[model samples]
Target chain A: DQQVKQNSPSLSVQEGRISILNCDYTNSMFDYFLWYKKYPAEGPTFLISISSIKDKNEDGRFTVFLNKSAKHLSLHIVPSQPGDSAVYFCAALVSGNTPLVFGKGTRLSVIA
Target chain B: EAGVAQSPRYKIIEKRQSVAFWCNPISGHATLYWYQQILGQGPKLLIQFQNNGVVDDSQLPKDRFSAERLKGVDSTLKIQPAKLEDSAVYLCASSDGKDSFQETQYFGPGTRLLVL
Candidate 1:
């Protein structure tokens, strides 16, 4: 079973606008959540992460918000740029010692 | 510092043939992991190791798959009598320690295997 799910397969947004990607998980044991960005034919690169203790974490123009009660999280990018176009994956981990469970991923297209 | 390294970026073979992929983690990183990603799907963990010892392999198919990490550094994954469903990109990643809750993992480009 897929513990993490990204309902949207793809998303499109115009440049200089906010792009929101959503993810949900069924396992409450997961305490750490992360987002990774991947380009075609390349490995995934870590973007940002948030601990379950906090409801939100921000890094530069990227922000991650977590709702433990709902078992959901979202990533928001402000003033999205064309360079932001890529596949975004959401992952969750029970701890540093365990392997991460990933969502199917969402393809984000930022139009110029 | 160099990131994780993988060999044989692409491979194609007939079904029931044998194939192997290699991976070298970042220097001084003790935790290594292998993952398989199918088209339009998230990556699935195949195996994990901590300093030459296996931490998890619950998802691995023992009948056809085997993996090893020698000297606590590099690793190899082998599939004997590969099946058509085994066609996917094999990814390697590494972290400084087993507890990666706070540490960032580095991933290699991955080896794309196509089984006909």
Candidate 2:
């Protein structure tokens, strides 16, 4: 079963515009959520993360909002750049020692 | 600091053949993990190791897959009599393993395997 899901397969946004990516999970036990960005022929790179305790976390132009009641989360990139075009994977951690469960990923394309 | 290092960025082999992939985690990182990512899908954890000891291997297909981490530094994952379905990108990741609350995993470029 897919514990995590990203409904959108792909997205396109104009450069300098806001880009929003969404994710959902079926497991309520997950306490931490993370977002990773990946380029072609490379591994995923960490982007932003949010703890269950907090509803939102922000790092520079990136912000992650978590809604516990909905078991959903989202990543927002403001003023998106061309470099921001990549596959974004949403991952969750149930506990400190457990492995991360990842979503199918959303491919974002930024056009200038 | 350098990120995780994986060998043989790409490998192609036929069915029933054996192949091995290696990884070198970042300096002083105690926790290591291996993942398999199929096309159009997210990565799935195959195994996790904490300082040369296994922490989790529930997702690993032990019948054809095996992994080992020596001296808590480097690790190797091997597949014997590989099948066509085994084709995927093998990713290696590492974390500090000290603080779970703030733990961040670093991943390598990954080794892509194609079984014909």
Candidate 3:
């Protein structure tokens, strides 16, 4: 079973526009959520993360919104840049010692 | 500081052959992990190590796959008698603390393996 799900396979946004990516989870026990970006042939890099305690967290141009009641989360990048084009994956930690479970990634393309 | 390092960026082998990948984590990191990323899929954790001892390997195919961290610094992953479905990218990640629940993992570029 897919514990985490990213329904959108790809998303396209124009430069200087807002790019929003969404994710959902079936397990309410997950306490920490993370987002990672990956380029072709490269491993994933950390983007932003949010804890179950908070509803929202913002860093610079990126923002993550978590809704515990719905078991859903989203990542928003304001003024998307062409350089931001890459695959994004949403991950969740199962417990204190368990490895993180990842969702099928969504590829984002920003056009100039 | 340097990020995680992986060797043999690309490897091609026939089915039933043996292949190995090596990784050198960021200096002073205490936790190490190996992951498998198939095409169009998110990465899956295969194993995790705290120092030279294993913390988790339940998802690992222990019958044909093996990993070791000799001195709690560097690590190696190997697959013997490989199968065609084994084609995937192997990623190595390291964190500064033993508690992965609270720490960030730094990832390496990864090693791509193709089995014929």
Against the true structure, what is every candidate's RMSD?
Answer: 1.1, 0.8, 1.0
Model 2 CA RMSD to the hidden true structure, in angstroms:
0.8
Error of 3 at B72 (Å): 0.2
CA shift at B17, candidate 1, in angstroms? 0.9
> Per-residue lDDT of B1-116 in model 2, one digit per residue for the tens?
99999999999999999999999999999999999999999999999999999999999999999999989999999999899999999999999899865577889999999999
Please give the DockQ score of every candidate, comma-separated: 0.71, 0.76, 0.73
Candidate 3's DockQ is 0.73
The full ranking of all candidates by DockQ, starting with the best, is 2, 3, 1
Judge candidate 3 at residue A12 and give its lDDT. Answer: 99
Using TM-score, rank the candidates from best to worst.
2, 3, 1
Point out where model 3 deviates above 4 Å: B98-101
Candidate 3 lDDT tens digits, A1-112: 9999999999999999999999999998999899999999888999999988899999999999999999999999998999999999999986475688899999999999
TM-score per candidate: 0.97, 0.98, 0.98
- Please list the residue runs of candidate 2 whose C-alpha ends up more than 4 Å from where it truly belongs after superposition: none
Off by over 4 Å in 1: B98-101
C-alpha lDDT of all candidate models, in order: 0.94, 0.95, 0.94
lDDT of 1 by residue, A1-112 (tens): 8899999999999999999999999999999999999898888889999999999999999999999999999999998999999999999988757888899999999999
Report the number of the highest-TM-score candidate: 2
